[model samples]
Target: MSLLDDDAFPDMDSVSRDRVAPYIIRTEKRKAIDANGKPLFRPRRTQMAQVAWETRHHLQQLLYEAVTDYVREGYTTRPCARRNATSVF
Candidate 1:
């Protein structure tokens, strides 16, 4: 029967005031690895990878500049990738 149906309610004539208790509860779950501060795993994001790629490209360009200008043509340097390409050699 529905709670709204008066017939479902404990009879007021027989039920005592102390007998009713519709209390509420709240909770937060802790995993097995729950620690004082650190999380078990780091969240995923794109900005970190973008920063790393920028650093790598900048370093590659600087090394290319140094090798082409300051070094001799016969001298061998670690090959760097060209634009839209995978490998230099």
Candidate 2:
């Protein structure tokens, strides 16, 4: 079964979610643990949004790296493409 299936990872905690594209499995960060040994996540005030933005940027970087690697491997013939690829970051 695919990860998109609800039961594919039935044991996953409620804090995690499956991504559609790139199929990333994201997990929540634990800020600390109490005496009971349960995970205590950071306050969500704006943390969730910040995390989402960071994830997006990370994916973009991955894509950029992949493209650069493809170009570096001589798969593309255009000189401008090579210049543009490395200029991304």
**Top candidate when judged by TM-score against the true structure:** 2
Off by over 4 Å in 2: 1-56, 74-89
lDDT of 2: 0.55
- Which residue segments of model 1 deviate by more than 4 Å? 1-56, 72-89
7-76 in candidate 2: lDDT tens per residue? 5445423213233323555554754677897777756564344333476598887887888997677565
Poorest 10 consecutive residues by lDDT, candidate 2: 12-21
* Global lDDT scores for all candidate models: 0.43, 0.55
Number of colliding residue pairs in each model: 0, 0
lDDT top scorer: 2
TM-score of 2: 0.23
The digit string of per-residue lDDT tens for model 1 on 48-89 reads: 443334665988878877778755543334243222122211
